[model samples]
Target: MLFKNIVTIAASAAIASAEDVYLTVKSDDSSINGNVLGFPHEGAGLNYFFLGTGSATAFTYDESAKEISYPFAGSYTQFFTVFDNFVAFSVASANTEITFEDNVLALNGSTSNFYACKDTNDPYSYSTRSYELMWYASDAPSGCLPLTLVNSGSAAASSSALPSSTSASSAAPSASTYEGSAVKYAPAGAAALLAGAAAALI
Candidate 1:
């Protein structure tokens, strides 16, 4: 009886703590990567709400419950990511891996490791054409073009503007007018309960 009561109380404490975990996306870009949206792309975000150095562009992330939100298919032209600095395991268990290009992610030491993966969500493979997926283990690849993912943005050249001249060429993440934040997923109050219990008891 004593053991069961202890378990019940321990579980409650765990739930409380897990409810509190959230991530703050910080841009590692030294210079603000301004987009066509007329706002800088250098900050932590999902779609619109961004956090920049100090509080210039700071806003709450547009996070929802129990779903990891994907940025609009077309948002960024080219965005930045850090390699091997620190790997923090995801707090939102709803999405185990983050989607950057085709890659899935895993927590690697203090550095969160990201790699290339084919889009499972798409009806067909997004990388079936000219592009190749990359996995940056310790650092960005040597002797390769500086790596950044391209997204759809107002600052980006129009579809008509994409070069017919070469398939290899692509634009960087474009500067754009800052819209409001895109809706993103967060853990549920229930998931928080489960995670919190696991955390405290473990």
Candidate 2:
């Protein structure tokens, strides 16, 4: 069933605070998907990409099978690949007020991208970019959703795609495809389980 258009929990408190950011990818074609995650590394800054094999932390994707694995979960981008020759999206973590200059709009705003990735392995190349994303949690409207989220600004700087020179000889990821599914940092019942574990340990 199509999910009801409801407010995500991320925007529940403080009304205008910018925290807990989440992203989802939708395209005209049903064969593609993109997944993203934000983790707080020892340092700070937002950096995520499929081409950055240089770092050890960015989420890993099996391009040949079109599968993605997130380390620490929340509302995250999932299963991204070369569905398009290149994919481009922008992230501004200044927590500055959202504005037209940011090219931001409602949740249904325009997200567009076109990429000429000379390297089929990494999509971080400036050449392989298309898509305009404006995270609006900073200035969302009343009744906005409050989902468990992590925005680009809060993302760790260590996140990056594997450098193309490094060959991740995994099965080629499934042909660029998309499957949109909201992930939770923890399942609903896990909270109680955790509390019980804590009590036992204590």
Could you tell me every candidate's TM-score relative to the true structure? Answer: 0.25, 0.23
> What's the lDDT for all of these models?
0.24, 0.24
Regions more than 4 Å wrong, model 1: 30-106, 112-135, 139-202
Query: What is candidate 1's lDDT per residue for 60-157, written digit by digit as tens?
Result: 12112222222212231211223232111112232222332322122222223322222212112222321122335556433322223222222222
Model 2: residue 31 alpha-carbon error in angstroms: 3.9
lDDT by residue (tens digit), candidate 2, 109-155: 22222211122333222213322121332443332222211123222
**Candidate 2, superposed: residue stretches over 4 Å from native:** 1-16, 37-46, 51-110, 114-202
Local lDDT at 138 for model 1? 58
Q: Cα lDDT of model 2 overall? A: 0.24
10 residues in a row with least lDDT, candidate 1 = 166-175
